[model samples]
Target: MVVNNGIANDARVIKTAAALRRAGAEVTVLGIATAGGPREETTAGGVRYVRLPVFPRRGATAAYLRFALARRAAHLVRDPRRWQRTLPSLRWYQRAFTRELRALDPDIVHAHDIHLLDTVARTWPPHRCPFVIYDAHEYVADLAVAGRRTRREVESWAAKERDRISDADAVITVSPEIATRLAAEHHLPRRPTVVLNAPVRFDGPADPGAPAGPVRSLRAEVGVSASTPLAVYGGALSTARGLGTVIEALPLVPDLHLAIVAVPYPHPMSQELRELATSLGVADRTHLIEPVAAHEVPAFLASADIGVSAILGTAASYDMAMPNKLFEFLHAGLRIVTS
Candidate 1:
């Protein structure tokens, strides 16, 4: 399996890897290594994780060049006339990515996103192609359309996705809505399979009730009185996630305090959130916490009076997404408020 993101906190990929391992398949996950993380490691589940070093060790030259090349490629894809200018840079990045992927030599290559498809395709031989499973986690084209990406970039990405899907042995998506849309968009021979991002199931008995020990301590640490109504948002601190809206609401809802558990990725929005909270005069009531282990998330949710998803409907992907965090809140018995 291959993915673009660091695999440490990718719940869906980890779950899929574990399931595949349990089904008696030897699984190896190839992903980009995060700063300060090991380049390679094997998990307890018997899945080998090999992280490709995409970023430079000390200098920013390589990283900047790669970014510039990616942008050039995007532009060239939209207007092929620019291929002469973009090809060299694009080839540099492609060669690096393909070099690492080719070392794996597996029977099947499961690509986790559209971004990795080009590299995966280029690495494997055309006549003797490995079984490729395009596991699209979201409608990336729509997502780019919703962001700062230009229409040309979006079209370029969409075209690439269509071409790759045509060659894929099978396609998999996170939701039925996405699957249907992808099928129609690409005019694929088969509809993509919908594998919902459901929360992991537990066979044990239901919780008797909320425990007071953790709740009481957590509240004290955050200076949230027992009587105060606390709402928790545990995910990326991005505008797309509607975290800004939640911060805006805090001033209006005088009695409520928001505990934001920022997702693992290094986010610039953390500063923005802090500024917004201070401006709104809700800084004292808002608590920003670092991300915790997956098993520890339930305890944090249980401590809150409510769980907030509030994801913006800027893109089709976000609009139709049945986010795992939503079910996580439900499983933890927190009342949900979604946008």
Candidate 2:
């Protein structure tokens, strides 16, 4: 089973799965299939892509209510707020994921995040011959740490994660900081594998194609003049992402157009960001837009002069994060400004 923790960054996972297949392994990706109803089947490269059944992700408010209702009484769970609404429900997904993994009966199972790490550590039966490998996408417990909540929450989650850490044949992480912390905390036998979050180095330059015209027209629709220096951020709009930094950066570069193409997250701050942008008197310059497909992201990023990626240092997860958008912006040839 080839598991990707999040839907916002599927292109990288898809590309990775394709390469794995070329090297001789049947791979199955677990997550949402598209923006519409969830579906599953083989991908272009013969790697199976399975979309788990999930609660519909409408917007910030609705998604929070849904998650809260679904998990009314939970201990030591991170704020569902940190996740993107488009992510398939983990609760509903676990069963289907297990069923398929067993059916596949692969030589190995590689998962993309701590959530999957926790899931497999607890459930993957001993009889199954699959040796598990986990990739730490982000340190989720750090979200609660930032809020100054009881470390009990983080500790509990970390303990479950340790269960995975002890058993996994291999552990890979996106950053050195994450690898260091996990190593220190768990008393790992040896250092975990560290893979920097970067696009695969292509052997040759990409063939030229025309830039997107419709997404470009979106700037005009929002009354953002074409001449204005466009500063943009994509992916889900969430609390921990520190979009306030994005908004605050707006006034610093006045006359700059800020395009926020936010996927609906189950965080209340998504709406608060809209209000904050409006109150900051930068509403006219700020274009709050809906999420776009992965293939279309380059076109949107291509039209921009700079990409804004700012997150507070308080959250360990945020501090350690190397989001796909950061790399995507670079791949799109945008300059990065971080705070």
Candidate 3:
């Protein structure tokens, strides 16, 4: 299995690996290592992780020049301008990923996204190509709009994704909505399988007379008294996630305090959010906590009275998303107020 992001914090990837392992399959995840993380490690479920080093995006000036010159040279023969800008960064990673993946010589290659499918397709031998599973974690083409990628870049990805899907042996998507759209949009041969990002369910009863779970004094940690009602929002602190709306609503509900337990990625809006809270005169009522491990999410969420998921419908992907945080809140038995 291959994924672009670091495996340490990817709940879906971790859960998928664990499930595969439990089903008597040997799982090895290839991913990009987080800074200060080991290049290789084994998880508790016996899943092996192999991380490949990525090259610095800014320092590849010579490579970028070469790519530009190559594009000009190829332009005369065939149009290469469509992927010119993305090639500079994508080229190095593609080469490195291809090298590492080829060495594994696996029976199956499960690529997590359309971006990695190019490398997988390029590396696998044509005559003896392994069964490839294209796992579409989201409506990837729409992700360009969500992430604010350029039009050219978005078009490039859309074309590549459409081409890659046709070559894939099978496809898997996170939701039925996404599956239906992807098939129609890409003109897929068959509808992709819907694999909901549901949390693991334990069937057996808890240990009799076992020690109680660890206590979390959220009010104490945030320097608030027990009388204050806490509204918790956990997940990525991005603008599209609609965290700012929650901050804006604080003044209207003066008695409610918000605790944001989030992982800031791509953009950390914490400082901006703090400023917003301060401007609204709710700074004291707002609390920002670092994200916790997936195993601890339920306990952390249980410490609050209400769970908030006010995602803005800025893009099609966000509008269609059934985020795992929603399920986490439900499983934690917290009252949900979602957009």
Best by lDDT: 3
lDDT over C-alpha atoms for residue 322 of model 1 = 72
Question: CA lDDT, every prediction?
Answer: 0.71, 0.63, 0.73
lDDT of 2 by residue, 16-70 (tens): 6656776788777776444235655545436667776444454467655766666
Q: In model 2, which residue pairs have backbone atoms overlapping below 3 Å?
A: none
Estimate the TM-score of every prediction. 0.82, 0.73, 0.84
Off by more than 4 A, model 1: 34-44, 57-93, 144-148, 202-226
The better-scoring model by lDDT among 1 and 3 is: 3
lDDT of model 3 at position 228: 75
- Which wins on lDDT, candidate 1 or candidate 2? 1
Give me the runs in candidate 2 sitting further than 4 Å from their true place. Answer: 2-12, 22-24, 32-45, 54-94, 121-127, 144-152, 200-226, 264-271, 290-292, 295-299
Q: Give me the displacement of residue 290 in model 1, in angstroms.
A: 1.4
Give lDDT tens digits, candidate 3, residues 1-339: 988877766777777776776678888898886533445654554678878765433334775566556545533433223453444446655866887777788888888877788778888667777889998887766663545455555556666787667668899888888999998987888999987777654231122233344345555677667677999998766677888899999999989999888774423677899899999999999998766555556766776889999988766677777777888898888899999
Cα error of candidate 2 at position 285, Å: 0.5
Shift in Å, residue 289, candidate 2: 3.4
Model 2 per-residue lDDT at 189? 79
Model 3, global lDDT? 0.73
